[model samples]
Target: MKNSKLLIIAAFFSIYFIWGSTYLFNKIAVTEIPPLFLGGIRFFTAGVLIMLIARFMKISLKLSKSQFINSVIAAFLFLVYGNGVFVWALKYVDSGFAALLASTQPLFVLFLLRLIDGQKMQRKSVIGVLLGVFGMYLLVSQKEISTSEGSVLGIFMILSCVLSWSYGSVFVSKADLPKNYLVSTGYQMLIAGFLLGVSSLIFKETWISPLSWSNKAQVSVTVLIIFGSIVAFTAFNYLLKVVSPEKVATSAYVNPVIALLLGWYLLDEQLTEQSVIASIILLTGVYFITSRKRIAKIKVTTKSQKI
Candidate 1:
């Protein structure tokens, strides 16, 4: 029991920190490789590698018919629409603006859970979501968003991605997925990757050999496959089982702060006072949501023990 709790904590930390670092790496990768192709390759490679590891560890990869269909649906919602469309949208929208829009995941997840599963929202969750939105707004410079040349269609696409991701997150929590997280994730990634590959072909993206990619781009892709896909995504799936979807979605709030800090460290970007304040506020909101979930978990465990 203690080990399970410890693993959950570790999983949260991995998603919070590791996924944050993926933004810069993804930016680098998508610069050279086509967005759809990049995503396809990244997820495909990660899925295969993870599945292989699981097999070596003697984990069953079998899936029932329902489980297979559920994995496919999740793959489409989470990876295909959620990520693929966002990648394509990046061409038309500024990254800062896109990040701001994607940060709406918690709000979307909150209402989706309520509407779909009839879960009631706590007042603290509502306050936390509001604070998170405000903090995200401050984190990205308003001047930048206003000045950037973003297409209306692109903005709409990203909003749709946010909705798809939020809905998928909630759906996965209730879906009849495989008993093993690794098996389910592997299938999800593989299915999404194949669909993305078809998208690349449809768009007529010329395949570039991985050997020809720049050292930095290669490294970025590697990091994304390992940390972003395997570690962080697996952690996210595990969290959905234990934590509230709203709390898991709070990672979106932290990701922008991580990007900003990375920008400061790597590119020497100015860390404005507003950015610092926003980070604090964003983290505080995350704390509130996470603490609420943690308290709920403790209560449930205590009740079970008493029974």
Candidate 2:
């Protein structure tokens, strides 16, 4: 039990740190490689590698028809729209800014949960969502009272990314999938990778030879495949099984912070005073929305214990 707890802690650290650094590496990679192509190669390689690992672990990789369809939908929503668009938009925006914008995912998930499942909404959570929106408006539009066209477009794309991911998250919960989380994730990545490869061809993106890629780009892509996709995602899957969903969801908040710090330190990305204030506002709002359910769960557990 003690060793298991230690492993869980290690896994949490992996997801928190590795996932956060992915935004930075992705920024480096997309500078030279086309977004879809990069996404294709990254996910495809990671998917294949992880599937092999799953097999070695003796996890069943078979999918029923319904499970396959659900995986397709999830792949389309998560990798195609969610991650692909965000990666494309990184060309025009700062990585830290992109991470900050993407942090609104929890708020979007809250809204989607209410809309789709008719889940009761909390007034505080609604307020938090609005604050996040306002903070985003300030962050993205500060260049002009009305945001610069490029910034506006990038912000919009990131929001769409958030929405796609949020909806996918909800959908996957109810969808039939492989019993093993790693197997399910591997299948989703495989499908999304194929879709991304097709998109790269459609757009006529030049596939740079690996030898021609800068050392930095090569390293970035490698880390993205290994740490970001394989290790971090595996950590997330393990954490989800052992921890409460809300505890696992803390990544939504921690990732942006890690992203922001790494961007500022490594990439020398922008961190203007206004941007700092906006990040605080945005992250705080996200915290409220994400934590609300956890708090409720704690209360319920306490009451039941008393009974």
Candidate 3:
């Protein structure tokens, strides 16, 4: 593909709009469908679709046993715990609020590096972490949200999901996997979907026919599977190859804003003054963290769907 201006714009649109829209979509779907089951169907269908596309494109699907194992591990951490649980939290948390919280992923990544890798925090990263912590406090301390039942638990779970995603980003950086990232993503999705599907059953979530789903749930799921899971990811990879890493990385800052606006407009989600202020402070912190030299690889390795 040529590095045409129009192509770049479209790719950015895919990553920014499609990914931001996913938060709203998941929120809509989870109102009716159980979260794990919703995750199962979305990822499984997306996995199959991506794998078929890979095959059609003549990309090799073969992986060594160890690679397959690593794929499963990545899937478990990233998709099952990170993304699936995050979706479950949407049952209680507003989509925009969750998106704002999830933006702290880069902070978690830096913290993990400091803990596990013994990497010294850069001055910028330190500042970013401080701001991120402060912003998070502001975000979660709202009286309206605190009064809502389950919102606190939902916020806690979403933060944990961010940690899971951060850990997975570190894992994928070192893990042996398929030569092609799309193939690796496909493998991860397939394994994660199956695991979450079984978990849904183990947890006794009711499964219903797709035809029985509410119109909104069905549309949301379709958008999630096709645009959120597949198309946005592909565009992310494409942009990384064609543009500067810094430019591609802007999605992290842009996504929460888009999510906030979309949620307010489409779902009638509240956008408190604290939330607006928190979003700015948090994204500023994220910018500081991601602006450093060490954070780029983690951004690249993190899932197409998550923080």
Candidate 4:
């Protein structure tokens, strides 16, 4: 159990760092590679690699018809559309800006949970949502919003991505997952990757130039695949098994900070005082909103068991 806890912590940090850095990496990759195509290829390669490993492990590839259908739906919402929006958004926004906008996902989830599960929104959650929105306002205040050539479209796309991802998370929790998360995730990735590839080909011009590989780009892609895709996801699954989903989901708050710092240092992106203030406000809001219910639940459970 101790080892497992350590592994989960490692996984949390891996996801937090690798995923945070992906926005910058995507920005760099798109400098030479087309957006949709790059996304499609990345997922496709990762999916195939995961599938191959599963095969070697002799994991059962079988899925019930219902599970198959659900997986396909998850792939569409989570991978194809969710990630698709991010890739599209990166074409217009700075990496740091994109990360900041994507951070609003927790707020979206809070609203969705309230509506769908009849979960009562605590006062703290409402306050948190407000703070998060205020943070967004601060973050976007300095940038000129323009649909034609700037962060405007990017912001919209990233918000859409957040919504899609939040919805996908709910679906995953509700759906009947296979006994093996690795198998289920592998299938979802494979199906999603294939669909994304096909969609990219139809919607955008594809490019893969051997000469386009810079040392940085190569390093970025490799890191994203290894740490971002495989290790982080594996850790996430492990954590989900042992920890509450709410705890695992806390990474949503931490990821933006890592992204901001990394973007500032590595990409020479500017971090304004407003950005700092906004981040604090948003994080505080998130803490209040997300933790209240969990804390309540824990207290109730303990009382009931003691009684």
Candidate 5:
């Protein structure tokens, strides 16, 4: 029991801090490596590592044909376009700003649910949507920030990626995914890694050899693969089984904050007053949406258990 409690705490820390730190690490590695190529190598290596771990744990590596297809689709949506392109955009945008922008995933997910499932929004959720929109406006409309050379394009691309990810989240909920989340994630990463490699080749990206990379880039990519992909992701899956989804979801709130701080401190990215206020509003909106979802989920669980 004591060890389980310690493990839970450690898992939460991994998802919150390690996952959060990935934004900064990705920015560093992407500086020296082409984004698609970097993502390809990172995810492929991570996928292999995860599969080994799964096998050691006696987890099944098998999946149905439909599960394989769905995993591929999910991989394309979540990693290839969603993550690879977002990292590509980091060349033009500050890591902190990108993190803030990416934090709007829940808002996009809420809207996507409405459109796809014909789900009605609750009052708090509606308020959250409004706040999220306003916060996004404040985030992007900063004259000094948006007018920079390619920042506008980067922001737009990142937003599109977020939409793709949000849609993937919804799709995965209803899709025939592998029963084991770790197995599912490993398959998605492996499939996405291959597709990203193809994309890199199609784009004719200059793939930097490990020997050619700077020490910083090498360290950054290593951290991204080992800590970011494997450790944090495994921690996330573990949390979903042991904790409330809402509690696990709180990592969303902390991730951007950690990114913002790390970017500002380590990368010397700009941290304007307006950005601070925008983050507050955006996270608040996310809190509203997630908290409501938590309540609804709890009620349903309680009712089902009673029956």
Candidate 6:
């Protein structure tokens, strides 16, 4: 039990730090790498590595036909479109700004899940979602107001990315995934990688290029594969085994904080007062929306047991 608790804490920090740093890495990578190619290489290599590791562990790789199809659908929605747009958006926006927008995903998830599951939306959850949306507006539009112009298309693309990811998350939760998390993730990554690679060929001209051995690009790609893909994912899987989903999901709130700090310190990105205020409001809103439901459920269960 103690070890499980320790693992959960480690997983939380890993997800928080690794995912936060990915925004910076993506920003640097897109400077020289094409967006689709960057995503393709990242996912493809990570998938291959994960598969090899699974094989070494003697894990079965076979999947039911339905599972395969579902994995592909989830991958297409989450990775191909979701991560694809993220990399593309990073080309236009600051990494900090992009992450801020992406962080609104929990709001989208809550709204969509309520609709699909036919779950009643609590008043607190609705207010939280509204506050979060307002916070997002403040963060994005503030920069536009100051600069007198902004990339409205870029904002839309990032929000689309968020929506795609939110849908994917809900779908994954509902889908009957393989019991082995590593195997499931490996298949999803492979499917997503293949689709992204094909999209790169069709939509992007520079799918493959002469390899450059620059230190910055090399470091960024290496960190993304090792820390972002492998370690963070493994940690997340472990976390789910040891902790409740609610606790693990708190990484949604923590990741943005890490992203903002890393962006400010390492990338020299400026955080306006509005951005700070928005972050707080958004996190608070998420807390209310996600936690209130759990709290209510617990109370009801306790009262029923007493009866």
TM-score per candidate, chains pooled: 0.91, 0.81, 0.82, 0.84, 0.83, 0.83
* Error at 123, model 5, angstroms: 1.5
TM-score of candidate 4 on Cα atoms, chains taken together:
0.84
- What RMSD does model 2 have? 5.7
- Candidate 4 Cα errors over 4 Å, as ranges: 1-4, 142-150, 209-211, 236-249, 295-307
lDDT of 2 by residue, 26-118 (tens): 989998999999999988999999999998998878889987987788788878888988999988777767876776776667666566655
Q: Return the top candidate by lDDT.
A: 1
lDDT of 4 at 169: 65
How do the residues 172-285 of candidate 1 rate in per-residue lDDT, one tens digit apiece?
Answer: 776778988888889999999999999999999988999999999999999989988888888888888787678789988888778778867986767788888988998888
In angstroms, the error of model 2 at 228 is 1.2
Q: lDDT tens string, model 6, 226-269? A: 78877787676555444333334455555666777787788677
Q: Write the residue-wise lDDT of candidate 5 on 1-307 in tens digits.
A: 9999999989988977897898899988987899999999988899998899899999999999988988888888878998899999999987767876776766676666567655666777777667766776676677645434799899899999988876766666556668887898798889888999999999999987899999999899999999988888767656655654334545655677678778778867677898789778867876676566443433222221100
For candidate 4, write residues 141-162 as lDDT tens digits: 7663223377776777788888
Candidate ranking under lDDT, highest first, comes to 1, 3, 5, 2, 6, 4
Instruction: Show the colliding residue pairs in model 2.
Output: none
Error of 4 at 21 (Å): 1.1
Stretches > 4 Å off in candidate 6: 1-8, 127-131, 134-138, 141-150, 208-210, 234-252, 272-277, 295-307
RMSD of 1: 4.4
lDDT of 2 at 31: 88
Off by over 4 Å in 2: 1-15, 127-149, 235-250, 269-287, 290-307
